[model samples]
Target: MELDNIDFQILWLLTENSRIQWKDLGEQIHMTGQAVGNRIKKLEDNGVIKAYSLIVDEMKVGLSYTAFILIYMKTSNHNSFIQFINEQNEVVEAHRISGEGCYHLKVKIHSQEKLNLFLNEILEYGNYSVSLSINEIKQRNPLIATI
Candidate 1:
C-alpha cells in the first residue's frame, strides 16, 4: 500500500503507544479525530497494521528465562518440527533463517528446570545451541526506525 506522510506519522505514533486516543493523535498532526480513525481503519484493512500488542515485563510475570535457540534439524522432513514449535507455549518467536541454521527460536520459560525440559523435547527433532539472555539493553518498536 502507498502510505502518505500522515500515514507514516500515524504508524510511528501508534508504534510508541497503540492505545493512544485518535483525538490525541490527531492533535499532534493537525487532523480531526474522525479523519485519523478513518486512516487507521484503512491501515488495518490493508494489513499494514496487523495487530496491537502489549510489551510485558517478563521478570515481573515470573517468566525468568529468555533464550535464543539456533536449530539444526537432524531429520530431512521438517513439517513435524515446525508444527511442534508452533504448539509450544514457551516458543514466543521462531524464524526460518539463512546463513547458519535452519531455524532460530526466541523462547521464554520460568526456570532452569523448565528450560532444560524444553531443550530435551527439542532433541526429538533437532540439535540446538542456546544462548540465555543475561540482560536486555534495549527494546524498541521497529516502526520507529523505519519512520
Candidate 2:
C-alpha cells in the first residue's frame, strides 16, 4: 500500500514510543484518536508494522559485549544452524542477506570467554568472522532513516 505523509508520521511517532496512546499520537499528527487508531490498524493489517519491542540496556542487564558476526556456512543444510541460533539467548538478531556473507548475527555477551565459547559453538554450522562493538555510537529505528 502507498503510504501518505500522515501514515509516515504515525509510523515515525510509534517508532519513538510504541506505548504512546492513540489520542497522544493523534495530537502530534493533528488527527483524532479514532483516526489514528484506524490508520494503525491498517498498517498492522498490511504488515508495515510487525511488532513492538523493548530496548534493554546491556549495562543494566550485565551484558557487556555486543558482537556482529558474518557467517560463512560450511554446508547447504541451514535448518540446524537456524535452530541453533533460535535456541541461543544471546542472539538478539539474525538475518540472511544477499551480499558478501551468508548470514549476519547480532549478539550480546558478558565477557571474552563467553564470546569465545559462542564463536566455538558456531563452528558446528560454519566459520564466522566477528566484530566487537567497543562503544555504541548510534542505534535508531531504520524507518526513521527512510522518513
Candidate 3:
C-alpha cells in the first residue's frame, strides 16, 4: 500500500512503542486521536501491522546461549526439514537463504546440553555450521533512523 508521511510517522511511532495511546501518537504527528486510531486500524486491516511483540531479555529467562545454525538439507527432504524446524520451540527465527546454506536458524536454549541435543537432532538431515553469539553490537527499529 502507498504510505504517506503521516502513515510512515504512525508506523514509526508504533514501532518504537506499540502500546502508545492514540492521543499521544496523534500529538507527535499533529493529528486527532480518532484519526490516529482510524489510520492504525486501516494499517492492521491491510496487513501492514502484522504483529506486536515484546523484545525479551533471553538472559533474564536463563536462555543465555544464542546460536545460529546454518542448515544444509537434501533437496528432496526440504518439506520434512521445514516441518521439523517448525515444531522446535527453541528455534526463535528461521530463514530460507541463498549461497552456502539452505536455511539459517536463530535459536536460543537454556543450556549447552540442550543446544547439543538440538544440533545432534538436525545432523540427521544434513551438514550444519553453528556459531554462538558472544555479544550484540546494535539493534535498531527498522522504521527509524539511527540519529
Candidate 4:
C-alpha cells in the first residue's frame, strides 16, 4: 500500500506511544478523533500495524537474565530442533542466520539456574554459545525511520 504523509505521521505517533488517545493523536495531526481512528483501522486492515504490545521490565516480572544463544546444529535435524525450541517458553525470539551458527536465540529466564537448565537441554542437539546482555544500548522499530 502507498502510505502518504498522514499515514506516516499516524504511525510515527503510534510508535512513540501506542496507548495515545485518538483525540490527542487527532489534535497532533489536525484531524478529528474519528478520522484518526479510521486511519488506524485502515493501517491495521493493510497489515501495516501488526500488533499492539507493552514494553515491560523483565526484572520486575522475575525474568532478570537475558541471554543470546548461538546454536550449531547437525545437518538434517533443523525441523526437529526448531520444534524443540518452539516448545520452550523462555525463548522469546529465534532466528536462522548466515555465518558461524545455524540459529540464534534470544531468551529471558528468572535466574541463572533456569538458564543453565535450558542450556543443558539444548546441548543434546549440538554445540552452542551463550552470551548474557549486560545492558541494552538502543532498540526501536525500523518503521519509524520510514517516516
Candidate 5:
C-alpha cells in the first residue's frame, strides 16, 4: 500500500503509544475517528502494521542477565540445532550469519548458574563463545519519518 503524509502521521502517533484512542488520534491529525480507523484497518490488511509489542524491564522481571552467544557448529547439518534454540525459552533472538560463526543468539536468564547450565546444553550442538551485557545503552524501534 502507498502511504501518504497522513498515514505516516498516524503511524508516528501510534509508535509513540499504541493504546491511544482513535478519536484522540483523529484530533491530532485533523480527521474524524472513523476515517482514522479505516486507514488503520487498511494498513493492517496490507501488513504494514504486524503486531503490537510490549517493552519490559528485565531487572524488574528477574531476567537480570543478558548473554550473546556465538555458535560454531561441529557439522554441516543445522536443522537439529535450530530446533533446539527455538524450543529454549531463554533465547530471545537467533540469527544465521556469514562471518565467524554459524549462528548468534541473544539470551536472557535469571542468574549466572542458569547461564552456565544453558551453555552446557548448547555444547551438544556446537562450541560457543559467550558475552554478558554490563549495561544496555539504547533499545528502540526506527522512527516513522526515517521509513
Candidate 6:
C-alpha cells in the first residue's frame, strides 16, 4: 500500500495510456516487465487501481446531450430513488451530497426528446433542476494531478 516514486511513475504512465504493454512501461521506468507486472498486481490487490476505463467520444456514439441534474427529494426514504437511478442506463454518474440537493446526477442521452422523457420519469421520485453542458473544458486525471 505504501507507494514509492517508482509506483507513482507507473501510475502516471498508466493514467496516460492504460493499454501500454508492461514491457514498454517498464522500459520507460527502468524496470523489467515482470517486476512492473508484480507492482501493478499489488496496486490492484490493494484497491489502488480499481478498474480500467475507456474514454469514448459521446457525440460520435450518439450521446450528444449531457445533463447535470440536482435532485430534491420529496420524502426521507431514498432506497426507491437509488434503485431507479441504478436501473436507468442514462444515469452515467450519481452522487449523494450535502448542500442544495439530496443527489447529483450526470446523465447522457441521444436527443432532446429522450432527455425530456428521462426528466419526466425522475418526477416520480423528486423534483430536479437540470443543466445542459455545451462543452467540457477538461477531464482531470487524478494520478497526474497528484504525482
Model 2 vs truth, CA RMSD = 1.6
Strongest candidate by TM-score: 1
lDDT of each: 0.95, 0.94, 0.90, 0.93, 0.94, 0.95
Task: List, residue by residue over 21-100, the lDDT tens digit for candidate 5.
Answer: 99999999999999999999999999999988777888999999999999999999999999999999999999999999
Model 6: residues with Cα > 4 Å off, grouped in runs: none
Q: List the pairs of residues colliding in candidate 6.
A: none
Candidate 6 lDDT, tens digit per residue, 1-147?
Answer: 689999999999999899999999999999999999999999999999999998998889999999999999999999999999999999999999999999999999999999999999999999999999999998898688789
Q: What lDDT, from 0 to 1, does candidate 2 have? A: 0.94
How do all the candidates rank in terms of TM-score, highest first?
Answer: 1, 6, 3, 4, 5, 2
Q: Any idea what lDDT model 5 has?
A: 0.94
Worst 10 residues of 2 by lDDT: 137-146
1-147 in candidate 1: lDDT tens per residue? 999889999999998889999999999999999999999999999999999998898999999999999999998899999999999999999999989989999999999999999999999998999999999999877778878
State the lDDT of candidate 2 residue by residue for 51-122, as single tens digits.
Answer: 998888889988999999999999998999999999999999999978887999999989889999999999
Whose TM-score is higher: candidate 3's or candidate 6's? 6
lDDT over C-alpha atoms for residue 142 of model 3: 68
Clash number for candidate 2:
0
| TM-score between model 2 and native | 0.90
> Which digits, one per residue and each the tens of the lDDT, describe model 4 over residues 7-107?
99999999899999999999999999999999999999999899998899888889899999999986755888899999999999999999899999999
Each candidate's clash count = 0, 0, 0, 0, 0, 0
Determine the backbone clash count of candidate 6.
Answer: 0
Q: Superposing all C-alpha atoms, what RMSD in Å does each candidate have to the true structure?
A: 0.8, 1.6, 1.7, 1.3, 1.6, 0.9
Model 1: lDDT equals 0.95
